[model samples]
Target: MSIEVGSKLQGKVTGITKFGAFVELPGGSTGLVHISEVADNYVKDINEYLTVGDQVTVKVINVEKDGKIGLSIKKAKDNPKPSSNRRKSNTHSKGNQDRTETFEAKMNRFLKDSEDRLATLRKHTESKRGGRGAKKG
Candidate 1:
């Protein structure tokens, strides 16, 4: 089988490492599956998802001129898990049935949150430094 970019194929997991996994392609070509490509969510450990000698479907995402191949196991899956950042509609609100936040409102909330975080960080830093401009008694 011709191993080209975007080509999907079944490969065996020959090795697993902290960064990624190595898969042996049909034509004896090996490819590296980066940790980010292992799944849709953050992959703290690759061993949690893949093991040596496991048959996994992979997509050929890149092929270097030096015979290096890059694969993605997440893309090979039919239905990947949705990102955690996608927020669901707020159904608990009783007053606003069809109310949607405007750009200005969202920006206001973001700014407020950022300000709060910065204040907290500044407070912590000041406390650690024994208060700003305080002369040691």
Candidate 2:
């Protein structure tokens, strides 16, 4: 019943908040499972994933000297699912060498694109003449 760092334990959700959920562990000790530790993917709402009285298996990531315990639900899983909700970068590839651009080349392209966008914006704003002279009624 003793909670230690790196130990996995089942706990009950005592309270839920925007930041994290308070879990009541064995031996009447409580731990805070941060929103980020609640899931492998982005947790926009902790309530959506956990609620008061919900049972969860958490891994003890840390037990602070001040008696604060940090727990992680994602690490407690035997096989965690990879988070695919994140946007994948199209600029780089592991096996595709042909599409890879050098750092200098990429910087040059970015600068050129930025310059072009600024030039286009300037041309657009300059062509405008105060929206028909403020539309005098």
lDDT of each structure?
0.87, 0.85
lDDT of 2: 0.85
Judged by whole-model lDDT over C-alpha atoms, candidate 1 comes out at 0.87
- Model 1 Cα lDDT, one tens digit per residue, 1-137: 67889888999999999999999999898999999999877799899999999999999999999889999999898876555323323434334533467888878878999999999999999999888777566
Candidate number achieving the greatest lDDT relative to the actual structure: 1
- Clashing pairs in model 1, backbone N/Cα/C closer than 3 A: none
How far does residue 115 in candidate 1 sit from its true spot (Å)? 0.9
Q: How far is candidate 1 from the true structure (C-alpha RMSD, Å)?
A: 4.5
RMSD of each: 4.5, 5.9
- Please give the lDDT score at residue 98 for candidate 1: 33
lDDT of 2 by residue, 44-83 (tens): 9898899899999999999999999999999999987654
